[model samples]
Structures are given as structure tokens and as C-alpha cells.
Target: MQPYKKLFTYWFAVIIYDLTVDFTKSYIKSFKLKEQMDGAARSGKQNIVEGSEGMQTSLKSAIKLTGVAKASFEELIGDLEDYLRQNNLKQFPKNNPKIEIFRQKAAVLIKKLSDFYKNESLVRNLSNLSYLEKYFNTSSVEEKVNLLLTLCHQETFLLNKQVLSLEEKHKTEGGLTEKLYKARVQHRGY
Candidate 1:
């Protein structure tokens, strides 16, 4: 599929990966923590691609891998939340004015992502992921993590939608085994 023609999971995972890298390099100093964050980022992105490719042969496998991607983001969210709390920073509520600002930026970032495939520069396209980096420049690390948490939650919610869609498709169209059974029946004239 062109530019990952599915839901936004892989694209959002790319954002998570870049944001985590920026956060790790700029704020966090622990190598172990960086490893965990980066691992989750990769898993979150890769699983979406893997699951999409598997859909041709196996819907069950695709649903399972999509769930894995969701799990990875959930892990990433926990890590971000822990970092915020342990650093003695305040976590913002959903109704916080600051969150609305960050949420709007996330919407802009998603629009930028749609233009990414046409961009010739890989570096430039990846730079789009760092749209939130400007806020991290002057803001407290706590604020930055809160913004990340907000974006992560949105992406996770959409992943849930993707999983549900896949499950419904499977229920309606069946899977490889069902196809094989039907083909066998047709050949046998049953």
C-alpha cells in the first residue's frame, strides 16, 4: 500500500518514536530508559506494518498484532506518566487549557504527516515528528511529558478502532481456513 494506506497507527508511532528520542536526548539522561522508550516506539510502529501485511493471509494474526501495537503505546504512556510523577511535576487534567493547545498541535502534526510521503528529504519528513519539540524548548519537562501523554492517548484510542474494524471484518468475511474450507467444498461439489 502507498504510504501505509491503513489507519494512522504506524504514522502516529513514528511521531512517538521521534518525540521519545527528542525527549531522551534533551531531558532524560538514563541510557536504560532511552532503550525502553525506543524499543516501544519501534514495536508500536513495526507491529502495525506487520499486521497489515499479514491481513491477506490471516485476519486473526493481524488483530493480534494490532493489539500488540496498542500494548506498546500503553507501555509508553505508563513510562511517560511515571517520569512526570517521579520528577515532582504535575500532570494536567483533560480539561486543562494547556492540554487543548497540545491537542491542537497534534492535529496539525497529523496533517503534516499526510504530506510526508511526498517529501523528498527523509530528514525533513522525520523533522515533522518534532513539531512538539518547540514546546519542549521553553516548557518544563513535566509539561512536555504531559503533551506526549495526550498524543499517546489519542493514538491508542484510534488503535482500538482499528482493532474493532478488523474483528468485524473477520466476523463477516472469515479467514484463511474458511476460504480453504469453502474452496474444498466447491471442488467436491458439496
Candidate 2:
């Protein structure tokens, strides 16, 4: 499959998993947390799409971007687990049965791409792009570039969105109130 397409599929799986969690919730206790998760999920998919588009022009840039995407998803997963535990939700089902199907599919695709890139030629060329080279060993230029781009976009998008949503929620929840109050107190004291 085209590298971009595979990346997109992986990202889409993440989104679906998030949606499942969101919909199954019996309570709406933490809107902010929910929003963050949703945003992270969207970001994962969006990044993949963006990276794929970027690859059409700059392979190197695309690879870097895909790296960002991969990081984002990994972060989101960590966040999800934390949130679940903090909220006293039951342990994520064995292998996360709820999202296992999608997770498995994404894992397989990522492994396949990783294996394909473990060729000697691609590895030598990628060495110059050190950050991206770690993703593959060696493969054709097109394959290596595409895979890197896909991963970057997916992960970055997820991380960025989750962070943004969290920030927004904090702002809405009086997190900035202390700063504002301090400023007012300083002005009065002056």
C-alpha cells in the first residue's frame, strides 16, 4: 500500500478507539478531559493526512512531520491510560479488548512498514536525516520517505491537539484567575 495511505489507516484507528471510549462513558464528569481525548484523536488522523500531502513535494520534510505524528499518538496513549486510572475506570481490558481490533491493525501496518524499510540502501541515505533514519533500516527512497512522513504527521497532530484542548480547558476553569487576582492586588498595592 502507499505509505501515506497506511499511515492514514493507523491514525483513523486511533480516532475510532477514542470515539468508542467517549461514547461508552456513563458519566460526563470531566468535559475537559473528554475534549482533550477527542482532540488528540482528531490530531492523529489529521497529521497523517497533512504529512501525506506534504510528501508529494518534500520527502525529507514529510518524514520529519510524520515523526511528530507518531510521537503524538504515543503521548495520547499514555494520557488515555492515565486518565482511565485516575478516574477509577476499570483496567483497560486485556490487550484493550475494546480497541484491540483497531490497535492490532495499526500495529501490523506499522510493523510491516518498519520491516520493509530495514533495507541497506535506504538506511545509508536516511543516515543523513538522522531524526528520520531511526524509523527505518533501508529501503527504496519512496518507501522510506513515505513511511516517515506518515508516522510524523499522525503522532504530532494527536499531541498538539490534546495539549491545546487541555490548555483551553484550564483557561476556562479559572486556572488564570490567580494570575489575574495577583495583578489586581499589585495594582492596588501600588
Candidate 3:
């Protein structure tokens, strides 16, 4: 199985990219902001994919790429925060009931994606973006921004956890170079 395909962070990054594209089209008038938002979202998704792909060969590379993904999402969150601040929109606090609801729903969506990947062989697509769109369809743009902010927070948290896990594994197992040296020594009957 492709490890990244099973990751909620990777799936959510894809969703963020698609939704940010659509969101910017309707709400943002500045081309620079639009491009930055889309690019950051895309970068987050791409880095996760690359990191997962490289994991077997080099845990260090995987860790670095995962860090890049986390940083990219951080940039996207900053852009979203700027958007809210500039427009004088209210961002929901961590303890808000609406944020709790969003977090619950987000967890469900992640589980759904994880199950789908486990049972099906399918290419990555925007098939699941509609779930998020429908979830906030009735909300105002400010609410949408809040939801996305909540999402970014969740994703960054997951990314950090993933990185720590990777670091621990790397420390225990060593990396590609160490493995290669061991294998070469064994093959030479050392």
C-alpha cells in the first residue's frame, strides 16, 4: 500500500488545494494572494506524497520532506489568517462549539478516506472534496474561513506527530547508508 494514500494529512492537503482554488476564485480579488494560497496548498500535498514515496529509501529524506509539507501548510494557514484579519471576520476560538463540531466531522472524514484506500484501488482525485463543500455550503464565507483554519490546525498537528514518529523510527533503525554498510559487511563475510 502507498503509505501516503492512507494518510489523513495527505488527503486533507488535496482537499485544501481544491477548496482553496475555488474559494479564491469567488472571494479573493488579489492575484498574488490567490496564487500564494493555491501554491502553498499544492506544495503541502506534493511534499507529503514525495516524502511517503521516499520513505523506503531514506528515512531522513522522508523526515525532511514531511517538514516541508508542514511548513507549507503553515504558510497556507497564515494566508487564511490574513484573509480573515483583513476582512474583519471573526475566527472561531479553539473552545468554540462550532470548532468542536468541525473537528468531529473532520475525524469522520479522515476515517472514511482511510477505509476507502484500504478497500479500493483508486488514483488520487477530488472525489471527496464535495463532502467538505457540502458540510459548509450554507455557511457564510467567514464561517468557511474558520472551518479551513480549523482544518489547517488539525493538519499541522498531524504533520508534527508524523514527523516525531519518523524521527523515532530513524533513531532506532538508522537510515539507508547504515543499512547499506551493514549489508555490504555481511555480504563480504565480515
Candidate 4:
């Protein structure tokens, strides 16, 4: 298969995985939890599709978008695990185990895409940066500085978004097990 096609397949797999997870999550009790999981799963697939749709005109941007999708998937998995543990339902065969399996599947897909894009061809190089610098053809030092700063801001925004998602996952996961355990015990009148 062609390289682009491979990328498309990867994105497609993510979309399918997300849909399946979302469907299964309907049986879950917490609406807030379900909404968060649904959002993350949708974001992962949407990013991939959106990026792939733009690949021909903006390869660098498309790859970056795909990265975002992977990051979203990672965050979703983390949150799901946390939710299960928080409810003290972590070891339950009906809940946590199935999610773990889905998480593993998503991880495999993420790893495959990461491996495929490890080369320079799919990324921006210093040469490309230089070209952009020259293309602007700005003679004033202040103007050059401004342009570079804008680029930096854009890059930083993307990085920070990914970081925030991961951190949210961590925060949500913590104390999840205790909460779940308590709820379970309470329900059991113990």
C-alpha cells in the first residue's frame, strides 16, 4: 500500500476504535464520566480524519494534527482507567478489563503511527524553517523577530494542549480507586 494510504488506514482504525468505545461506554452510569470519555474518543478520530483530509495541501500540519489525535487517545485511555479504579471497579471483569483491552489496542495503533512518522520526510526541517525565514524577505530585525515569535507561539500552543490533556488524565485518575471502593462498599451495606 502507498504511504498516504497507510496513514489513512491508521486514522481509520482509530475512528473505528473510538466508535466502539463510545458505544460500550453508554452502559456506564456517570454522565459526566461518559461525556468526558466520549469527547476524548471523538477528538482522536476527528483529528485524524481532519488531518488526513488536509495532507495534500499541508503535510506538516496534517502530521501535527495526527499527533494531536494520538495524544487525545492517550488521554482518554488514562481517564477511563482512572474512572474504573476510582469506583473500585478496577478488577471487575465487566468494566475495567474490557477498557484495558481497548486501551491496549489504541496504544498499538498509536505506536504504529509514531513509528511510521519517525523519519524526517514527514517533519519540518531547519532548511524548511530557513526557507520560511527567507520567503518572508523581511529586512527589519523587528519584523523577523515577530515572525519567528508567532511561529513559536503556534508550536507552543499545540504542545501545551497535549500536555494539559495528559495532566487532566492524571488528575482524574488519582483518588478514583478510593471513591469507587467507598461507593461499592456503601452499596453493599458494609
When superposed on Cα atoms, how far off is each prediction in RMSD? Answer: 2.5, 17.1, 2.3, 23.6
lDDT of 4 by residue, 1-190 (tens): 3344344334333433444253335445777766776776667667666765655455455656767876665665566455446655423232444334443443454355556645545333222434333444434433332322232223234445544553554356534455678889999999
lDDT scores of the candidates, listed in order = 0.80, 0.47, 0.85, 0.48
Q: Which clashing pairs does model 4 show?
A: 85-177, 86-176, 86-177, 86-180, 87-180, 88-180
Judged by TM-score relative to the true structure, which candidate is superior, 1 or 3? 3
TM-scores for candidates 1 onward, in order: 0.87, 0.42, 0.92, 0.40
Candidate 1 lDDT over 93-147, as tens digits, reads 9998888888777676566665564555643656664534664342667777887
- After best superposition, candidate 2 residue 43: deviation in angstroms? 1.0
Error of 2 at 50 (Å): 1.0
Residue 153 local lDDT, model 3: 90
lDDT of 2 by residue, 16-115 (tens): 4333243324333577766665565566566666766765554444455555655656655665455455655543333434334434444554455445
- The per-prediction tally of clashing pairs is 0, 17, 0, 6
lDDT by residue for model 3 (132-186), tens: 6776552688878888888889999999999999999999999999999999999
For model 2 the local lDDT of residue 155 reads 44
Q: Is candidate 3 or candidate 4 better by TM-score?
A: 3
TM-score of 1: 0.87
> In angstroms, how far off is 37's CA in candidate 2?
1.2
For model 1, the run of ten residues with the poorest summed lDDT: 129-138
- Candidate 1, lDDT over the whole model: 0.80
